[model samples]
Target: WNYQFLTQLGYPSNYYAAGEMTVSQHLEVSGQPDPYNPGWVGLDYIFGSGMRGGSSGGPHIANLGEIVDSATDPGQFPDRNTIFAVTSWGYGLGNSSGTEIKIQGASPLSGVANANNFVDLFNAACRRSRAHFGTWTCDLLVP
Candidate 1:
């Protein structure tokens, strides 16, 4: 988890204040609705993390590794550093006194079966960028 300020009661402080956690659960496209907060939806992946505040929009990347621009082999899945989701919300298992177990969540960036996918969104942004700049700026990264 990435945050600017560490507000959790028992959480420690460090430079950059960033940490990574393994995702435990992945909710489906249907998502979970909160009864406590009306019209609020929770369609995200759950993981164990101590990050509390100022980390809402951090990226949740999958297959993260070194950028291998190999001379022999281009390597498998060029988009290995792709961000699958972004941090949404989290909570701790305790009361106002203190927290015991910390858990975090992030909503997926794209679902394979979804009508409006990440590719569409990315393309739209690229188109808009080209329209304004008279050149395809995104082509350098994607193409």
Candidate 2:
């Protein structure tokens, strides 16, 4: 799974403040015949706003956190039917110090048959959030 903030021109945004932060977490399954197995491998990654910006750069871009399950049923082979679940959040410069901005999502299997499926889901979420905030453009680069 992936998370991104697109600029008004469909690029990325650069917005940051002191003590501001963003994070992402997720689970994924890899190297498995059946992508729905519960024994799949898991992974997690975290990104936070530092003295400057996050790891991506000032005005953090995309922060990607995901879990991968590489364990297969042993008898099954690899296929494009892999399933993945992911969640992410973003932080922008706020008026108050220590204030935070975040976004998150969870799905049983996401039911995404392919990469495009996942992309569509995430893009929709971003657009929705942007509309609520009244922000036209933003930058998104996963770290």
RMSD of candidates 1 onward, in order: 9.1, 15.8
Best-fitting candidate, scored by lDDT = 1
Compose the digit string of candidate 1's lDDT tens values, residues 1-143. 22221111122222135344323223223255553578876555566675566667767654456765647765454555566667777777867776577776666666534434667788788788988996746642332
Give the clash count for each candidate.
1, 24
Looking at model 2, residue 96 earns an lDDT score of 61
Off by over 4 Å in 1: 1-43, 69-78, 95-99, 111-118, 128-143
- In order, candidate lDDTs are 0.54, 0.33
| Model 1 poorest ten-residue lDDT run | 3-12
Best by TM-score: 1
TM-score of candidate 1 to 2 decimals: 0.49
lDDT (Cα, tens digit) per residue for candidate 2, span 1-143: 33323111011233344333434222322233322347653232222322222323312222223436576653332332222332233345445666754322223233334434655665667677788876564322232
| Residue pairs in clash, model 1 | 1-19
- Backbone clashes in candidate 1 total 1
For candidate 2, give the lDDT of residue 1. 36
